[model samples]
Target: MRWFWIFAVGHLLLWTAVPFFTQANGPLDNVEMLNWGHEWQWGYPKHPPLPAWAAEAATYLPGGPVWSTYLLSQVCIVGCFWAAWRLGRETLSPSLALAAVAVLEGSIYYNCTTPEFNNNIMAKACWAMFILFAYYGIARGRMVDWGAAGIFLAAAILSKYDAALLLAATLLFSSLHPRARVCWRTPGPYVLTGVSLLLTAPHLWWLVNNNFATLRYIAARSSTSPSWLSHFEHPAEFLGAQLGAVAVTLILATILLGWRWRFKTVDSSAQFTRTYLAWMVLGPLGLALAYSLITGAHLRSMWGASMFTFLGVLLFAWLEARPDPALIRRTIYASAIVGGIFAAGLGLRNMIGDSLVTAPLRVDYPGQQLASQVEEIWSQHSNKPLENLGGDWWLAANINVYHPDRPSISAEQDHDLPAWTALDAWRTEGGIIVWETATAGDNYETQIKALYPNVEILRPLEFAWTKNQQRPPLRVGMAVVPPLAPIRTAELPTPAQH
Candidate 1:
C-alpha cells in the first residue's frame, strides 16, 4: 500500500506538471471537448456528452487555467490505479496488488497519451471502476455494490459508446460463470440492469431525438475500407497494435518474475479469481477483433485504451508466481524509469520541437495570440460580444478556449452545425468566420459567399508559432457576416463591391 501511494502520487504529479508547463495549447481533442462542453448538451455529433462535461467542469475550477484539463487527465489515471489496486487486493497479497497497479505505468495509454483529456481517458477510469464494482456485486451479491456497478457502467457508456464492449464482456462472463450465474436468481442483477437503464435514459432519449447522430458517426468512421482484404488486414493490425500497447507491461513482468517463472495455472481454490481476471482482460479485446473480422470495420488502436486494466493481475494470477520484495523493488524502479523517459521526451519536445520536427505540432498552436487577434477584428465590426464563431473546428475551438467571450462555434468546416447552435440567431447576432489562409482554397471562399452573400473578407493576419517561431508564420483568413440590423454607421461593402 505504501509503495502504491508513492507511485500513484508521483505519477499524478509528474504527468500533470509536465504538460501543464510545456504545452502552449490544449491538444486537438482537449480543446474540441472544451468547445462541446461549453454548450452543455446531452450529446454531440461525434461522441457522447460525459467527456465534454468533465472538461468543461475542469475549466470552471479556481483560476480556470488551461492546465485544469491536464490535471483532470491525471486524476482519471490515478483513479484507475486506485480501482485496480483495490480490486487486486481482493485476491492477492497487499504487495502483489500494489505491483498490479504499478505495472500499468508501462502502458502509454495511462501516461503518454492521457494529457488529452478526451473520451478515451474518461472511459479508462470508468472501465476500471465498473469492473471493480461488478466483481464485488457478483462475488458478494450486495445490492449496493450492484447499483454502483450499474452507475459506473452507464458512465462508461456515456463517456464513449465503446464501453458497450465492457458491458458485453460483463454479461458474457455472468452468463457463463457458474458462480456468477447464481446472481441471476437473486435481485442483484436486476438492480444493476434497472439502475443502468434509469441513469442512461436521458442520453438514450437524446440519441433518439437526434436521429442517433453518435451511432451514425461511429458507423461512418468504421466503414473506411470497402476492400475485402480489409477484413483480414484491419483485424490483424488491431491485434498487433494491442500487443505493442502492452509490450512494456510484459517486459516489466518478465523482470519481476525473472526467467524462472513458469506458465502454470493457479490452484483450484483460486480458479474463480483467475477466470474472472482472464475474462475481464480478454473479453472486450476479443469482441472488438471479432467485430472487425466480421464487418471489415477499421478498428482504431486507441479504442483498446480501456481494455487492459486487469492485464497485470491476469498475468500474475496465470503464472501463480509469488513476487518477493526484491522483485517488487526492481519492478518499481523499472516503472519509474519508463515514466521518466516519457516525461523527459515530452519536455524536450516542448522545449526544442522547432528544430526536431518539420511540421508544427498541436501544442505549438498559438491559441491565445490567435484569439486575441480575432477578438480585435470582431471589435472593429460590432459592439456586440463575439457570441458566435464559424469555420474549422480546430481553429474555432482553440479561439473559443482563449477568447474572453468564449464564443460558441456556430458553424463547422464540414458545414454541419451543432444542434445547440441556432442558425437564425447566429446570423442575426453576426459573427466572424476564420480559417487558415494557406488552406483556404477557392472552395472556402465559394462556401462562405454562398452562406453569407454580404460577407466581408478581412485582411489576412499572420502570427508565429507559440513555440516553433522558426516555422512559417500561420496565416489566418477571416470574413465577417454583418448583422441583420447595422450597429455601426460605417456599412462594410460586400464582396462584389470589393
Candidate 2:
C-alpha cells in the first residue's frame, strides 16, 4: 500500500508541475487540433476519435487551453505504467515491480511529444487497458477481466488500424507459451473478444459514412517496405525511435531473459514471460519490422504501441538481482527526474506548439496578405478590374479562409472552393500583372514594375516574423502591383458583365 501510494503521488506531482508550461502566450499549432472541439464522430479524416475525445474533456477543465489535451494524454500513459508494475510484481519480486514502473514512466519520449492527442492516444490507452485486463483475467480467473480485455482491444483497433498487428502478436505469443492451449479454453478471453466487437461497431458505421477513406488510409500504410530507401525511411526511422524510447529497459530485458528462463521456476512467472514477449519485446518492434518487409509502405512508429515502457520493468528487475536497497533508492530518484524531464518536454510542446513536427510554422493561403494590399491598390486606382497572374488553388483557398475580400481567379479543386474570388472575373485585365514573393502593401507597383523591366522597385511585400511563443518561426508579407498601360475595357469587361 505504501509503495502504491508513492507511485500514485509521484505520477500526480509530475503531471501537475507542467500543465501550465508554455513557450509563448499563444499556442501556435494549426487549426486541426482546435477543430476537434467542434464535433465528434466515430473517426476523423486524419486520426481516430480518441485524441479529439480527450480534447473535448480538456475543454471542460478549468481554464483549460487546447494544450491541456496533451496533458490528459499523459494521464492515460501513466495508468498503463501502473498496470505494468502490477504485472511485474505478480510474477517477480516487489523490487522488480518498482523498477518496472520506473523504467516505463521514466522517459520523456513516450509521455512528452509522442502519441499526439489523437487516435494515437486512443490506441495507446486501449492497448494498455487490454494488456492490463488480459493479465488480470488470465492470472485471477475472473470474467470481468475477460470483458475489459475485449473492450480495450476493440477500442485500440478503432483508434488506429495498426493495433491489429499487436493483436496478432499477442495471440501468437500466447499460443507459443507453455500454458497457451489452456489459456484459450477459458471464459476470460472469450468475454474480452465479445466486448471488443461491441465497441468496434461505431467505427464500422463511420467507415461506411466516410466512404471507405479509412480503409484506403489503412491499406496505404499497411505496406511493409518499398524498393527505394525514401519509401522505407519513414518506418525505419519510426523503428529506431521506438528502440531509443525504451532502449534502457529492452537491453536489460534481453540480458535478464536468459537468466529468468533458466533459473526462475515459478509458474506464475510464465505470465510475465508471455507479457514480455507479447507486448514489450515482440509486439511493437516485431510488427514494425513486419510492416517494413511485407507492406512495402513507410511504417509509422506509434502505430498502437507506446507502452514499450513496460519492458523497462524487466531491466529494473534484473538490476534488482543485486537486492541493494541503496541502489534501488538511487534508481528511484533518477527515474523520477528522468520522468519529470520527459513530462516537461511534452508540456512545452503543447504550450509552444509542436514545432518539432511542423517546419517554419507559417502557412500560405492564396496570396492572403497580398490580396489585402491589392484591394487597397484597386480602391486607390478606381476599383477598376485588374488583370492578375500567378494565382493558383493554394492561393485561392487562403484568400477564402483568411482574406475573404481579396478576390482572385480559382477553379474548383484542392485549393479552390466556393469563394467569391473565382466569380469576381474583373481581374482579367493583363497589363501589369502583380505577382511577388514579398512586397509592401500597395497598388499596381508590382504589376507595373514586372511589366516594365527598367522600373525601380518601390513597395515590395514586407515580411516579419510573428512573435508567438508556442509556434516555431513564422513570417507574413504583402506586395503591390502598378498599372502600366491604360485600362483596356474591350478585353476587360466589368465583373457584372462577365
Which one is best on TM-score?
1
Q: Which tens-of-lDDT digit does each residue in 1-498 have in candidate 1?
A: 777888898999999889888888888888888988999988888998998999999987875547888989999999899988887887677877777777888888887888888999999999999999999998888999999999999999899999988988889999999988999999998898899899889999999988898998899888857799999999999999989998998888887666677766556647887788789889999999999999899998999999998888777777755457888777768878888888888888877876687778888889989999988888889898988777766677888999988988754423233744564755588888888766656566766776677789888889898877778898888888877733332212222100
Task: Give each model's whole-structure lDDT.
Answer: 0.83, 0.52
What's model 2's TM-score?
A: 0.66
lDDT by residue (1-498, candidate 2, tens digit) is 477558766675566455434322222221234343335556765556655565666656665343465456666666666767766666656765676666555444454543345666556666667777776776677898788788778877766776777787678766766555467878777787778888888877877777776666666555544466644576667678776766654433433343444332335565455444345445766766766655556665555255464565544433325456665665556666666777766665554554454443332122334446555555565455543422333332233222333233322222211222222232233212233333223443444334344333434344332324344222322223344433322211111100
lDDT of 1: 0.83
lDDT of 2: 0.52
- Per-candidate clashes come to 0, 32
